[model samples]
Target: MIKSMTGYGCGARDNHKVKYTVEIKSLNSKFLELTLRLPKAFSDKELTLRSECTRLIERGKVNITVTVEYVDQTAAAATINTELLKNYFRQLEAVANELGTNRGNLFELALNMPEVISHNEEEADEEEAALLLNAFQEAVAQLNEFRKDEGVVLKQDLSTRTQDILRLLTEVEAVETDRIPLIRDRISQYMDETVGKENVDMNRFEQELIFYIDKLDITEEKVRLRSHCNYFLQALDAADANGKKLGFISQEMGREINTLGSKANHAGIQQIVIRMKEELEKIKEQLLNVL
Candidate 1:
């Protein structure tokens, strides 16, 4: 079955120490393009996360955002520089003595100094990583489900459009029968009027008419176009990433339809060919989002 490249998914987990939220958004792209946002502590695991996303999403412009909120205040434990604080206080006291100014809030000012309070870098925890991975997997699963649902709609539209083109092809066949005879009669009447019926060479005229009709015959194009349409449907039914393949088939279908249009001298057949082209164009537009 075909899958659409556009989708959105989110998964979140909240616990005592931390809260993990994963959001994934995707849009149609020719290749798998990924943009990942991760916490600094999890920066080392970015490659693993990217690889996992690439494995699941073959083609799309994918954006993944991971939010890690620390619920426990102690998660980011801060240490005070006692020595620095005391040194600042002593310096401030000396300045106060020299200038005879009150050292009001001196302790608070010292505590607010740069580097006086610093957080210790926490080591990566395997358990927390596993939990985050679980959330990430859930988000991916949800995205796949979204893609599948969108794929069903695309499949239906594409299939219906293909059938419409086939119906137009049948209409072309209906009008095609009278086209050659009309051409022959028109040419014969013109020759009889200009060159006189007795002077015309019937044998030579028959040979030339046969050659002309053969050049304009759309039998091969119609057969090939039908085959291409069937192949497109088959690929859509099979389990694989056939977006590019479908595009190639659509191009082939376009070629046949154009050929039919050019060869169809009859006005009714050309109109039917135009309708076929319109349906094929719709299929191409929808294929852009298919994977």
Candidate 2:
């Protein structure tokens, strides 16, 4: 069960003349990095919201936005700064008297200063808070649903690619087996060319041939590659949020593949190694989105 790290979901609830909306967006990340946007009144709930998102999404660069709108007049509570206004008026009266300028609009000018008409950024009631949190929960659920759906497609493609790698491995094995007899014949021909056919040292030649063939043998690489494939599938099954683990396994798989390529002296085996590398590359691309 693989899940993509990219998804989006939005949920909204309106009640008692207040409307709460929550939206979540996720993108691939090396770790769980969450950014939350909320009204000042709800700032205290940031940690709670982030924690809930972490538990749900597991890994990603997640951005969550919460908006609460008041549909009623009470939602906008304006407060006047009486002391500041009085002081402003007194200072302006003196300034106007000294400069011989009009003081008629001084009060209006003072009223327009920042913070003079402060309003309580609307706060949700307890019931409204519950609704908001519920909406957030729903958003996270929907986001994960989208990721899961994408994950199904990814899993199918990756499984196909894994099978392709296996096929290429089989081709490499065939090429490997065919090389041994070819090497024996070439060694015999070389011995005949260097020394007279009657003077050929059969025992020494056979031993040397065996040693050279063993050096070119990819049996260990094949065995380890096959084992890595099986281990990869097992890890995939056990993985919950194992993107990094999968990546590490991929590195090991690549090591074996590279070794197989380097040891391959046959043209067919080289071609198979190329195909295997292509499949592995595709798997690596898909792994980027896995969680």
Q: Candidates' lDDT values, in order? A: 0.88, 0.84
Score candidate 2 by TM-score against the native. 0.87
- The clash count for each model shown is 0, 0
How does residue 257 of candidate 2 score in lDDT? 97
Cα distance off (Å), candidate 1, residue 196: 3.3
What's the true lDDT of residue 48 in model 1? 95
Cα lDDT tens digits, model 2, 10-43, are 9988776778899999989888989889887777
Q: Which stretches of candidate 2 lie over 4 Å from their true place?
A: 92-109, 112-114, 122-125, 187-200, 237-241
The RMSD (Cα, Å) of candidate 2 is 2.7
User: lDDT tens string, model 1, 19-120?
Assistant: 789999999999999999987778888999988987888889999999877788787687999999999888888888899987887888888888788763
lDDT of candidate model 2 versus the reference: 0.84
